[model samples]
Target: MNTLLKSQLWRGLLLAICLPGVAMAASIQALNYSSREVDYIAVENPGNTNSGGGGDSIRPYGQGGSICCFTVPEKWHADLKVVVVYQLSPDPTFHRETVSVPQYPDGKAGDIWLIVYEDGSVGAVVSLYGPSRPEWPGKIKGYPVPTKEYRDERRKQKLKREKASLLTVERGLLLRGNSLPDEKVKEIQEIIEFQKKVIQSLEGNP
Candidate 1:
């Protein structure tokens, strides 16, 4: 090997031996905007594996699990499929929400936002986030999604809902033709656009 290659090889070997978990390490945080403090959590390790157990980089939780820097390294620009689980504030019941987010520009190293309730329960919102605010949305209440398995199920159900919605709107538009009011047509148009986006997103995975 050339000098640079040899040097890199040694560095990898050293990290593997001396600091095994550094490569697998991921950080979890609970955001408390009102209090103005970020709370960090220690997470369990289950050795990092590449997505799909193959060349694909996105790891599916299958049922459920933790993701960190070991799996998605810092500076990674791709979006991730993740579930945020928490209890609805004051309800004492658990909820799960699925989201896709890449690492954020302002994010700290290894930081994964843990959904928290305003009253201090864990993840509660079941909303998909856009790229702009990669961090978890705080304190939104929704129905309970108990496990990663349930979260995955919910995700599938959502896609189905979108597909059905798109078909309905298209059929309605065709039937009504030019007779529909502008306001009514505009509302359906927005829903059609949103459903198309959701369906297109689902096509990328399973």
Candidate 2:
């Protein structure tokens, strides 16, 4: 082969090996907890005080509580900033417990409507709702009734409830300082890109 062609081939081979290492550096492995282990996950918002009526069988709280923890890769910890996003409903009448992220070591917990770490890089969105309460004739016994005068108050409330019932979408990322790493962020970028395409395709958007 010609010298210039050989040199180009060598460069391509080197890049192929180095690229995977760069992608692996910023990746995180998330561990979804069972009902028996203790782990710590960070929270975003601090004052959101809602006890989501105990926790359901599917959703557990605290140590031995149902939670998902991310075991961050060691190399990225020092150089990367992790961000968590918590998405919660803005409605005021929901009877569920306040959403929160438990602090590490201290095991302390607090209400955070949504937690965003590293700005918008990485985070988990949580849904907080209460179980249905019993009903009575004059007024639904335990649940509070709306006093708003709007003609479609019930319709508006129904819309809000449906919105609140949505699964909170949480995204996580390992970014360099506050900015996304140029070439280094490719792996995650590809995942995000693919998701965007999938969503657009599903929505029939061009």
Candidate 3:
């Protein structure tokens, strides 16, 4: 190993050791293999907090996928615990568990992964979300996203929802004979044409 690589590994290990409640971060295995700090990703379950304290709870933004991510922009100094409640199951109350990751100083751009599993245990998830994320594009990073093949389907679904909403408003306007401002009328016309094109594209019509 090179001097720089060894130095970073030691730093990561020392941080883990100093952290009071890190669950299972023995050696900084991922850090040792990383070319940069962003490449060093760690995951550990920190146990559940039924009251939902310690960190941010990020639910789905109603766009796509079945995952949640919580991040603290300041720095990675301590373990951030998240409570994952599984609401769908035969049992009345589902499992509630927590997971966490060692702190990443803001410059390192580190991220903590949280997964709500079927068994009701929310723990440290891995980085299998892939390379490109067009859904959120830039805001969301180092997180799980649907595959490119599925992105088109998601986009289509979003467009359909928007189209339905527009039609509902336009119907109301028609019944009331309301005179919408000129700009509003133009915007709605553009949206109608856009939806028609999207539907045709999805059907492989051209």
Candidate 4:
């Protein structure tokens, strides 16, 4: 074979051997959030002061039940769809809300925002308060609701009891100022764009 043809053949063989390894590395770098089942008490009229009957008129909302929860590690991103079913006479109402929470800006690590939708249209954005927050909106008064103090105390006690269980897979890797590789970050942004497209498709928005 001519020298030029031999060089070309060698280049092709090298690329064939390296391409699969590159693809496998890319797959390993991708982050995924584990779906967890959590029970949260859905309160109707979150603005209601009284914890009336669990229905729609006064304190209309069901008690705690299992719902899928997604926990995204820092420097990663996740799109979660939370569905809540309201049981009422005539017909039951099913509400599906999608939230895209990106774990950037390390200070907002614990911040959670709820995107409410009505008939596939954006309704409101509700910020979920974590254990350090003073108060949560729509909190029923005169009721023995779990307070932030209670949660913090329980979390500390649990951590003390089960130190091994407190270690997350990405614990030390998610420290402040920690960042994913530039290529991985760009890939994550593309995933976010894809999730946005999915949301728009679900809402029937062109």
Best by TM-score: 3
lDDT of each: 0.45, 0.30, 0.40, 0.31
Tell me how far the alpha carbon of residue 124 in candidate 2 is from the true structure, in angstroms, after superposition.
Answer: 8.7
Which stretches in model 1 have alpha-carbon errors above 4 Å? 1-23, 33-71, 106-108, 115-206
Measured with C-alpha atoms, the lDDT of residue 97 in candidate 2 is 23
Q: Which stretches of candidate 4 lie over 4 Å from their true place?
A: 1-69, 76-91, 102-108, 111-206
- Ten residues in sequence with the least summed lDDT for candidate 1: 54-63
Give the alpha carbon lDDT tens digit for every residue of 19-94 in model 2: 5324211111122222221123333222433311112121111121333322222222223323432222232222
Task: List, residue by residue over 1-206, the lDDT tens digit for candidate 4.
Answer: 99999999978755653453231001000000111111221222233324212112211121222222222222333442222223323334543333343333332222222221112221111223432244432122122244455446555655444443223312433452146776765665565555555544434421
Please report how far candidate 4 places residue 27 from its true position, in Å. 27
Better of 3 and 4 by TM-score: 3
**Which residue pairs clash in candidate 1?**
86-122, 86-123, 115-123
- TM-scores vs. true structure, each candidate: 0.28, 0.17, 0.34, 0.20
Point to the candidate with the largest lDDT: 1
Q: What digit string (tens of lDDT, one per residue) describes model 1 on residues 137-162?
A: 33333322245564566679888888
- Compared with the true structure, model 4 gives a TM-score of 0.20
The lDDT of model 2 is 0.30
lDDT of 3 at 155: 67
Give candidate 4's whole-model lDDT. 0.31
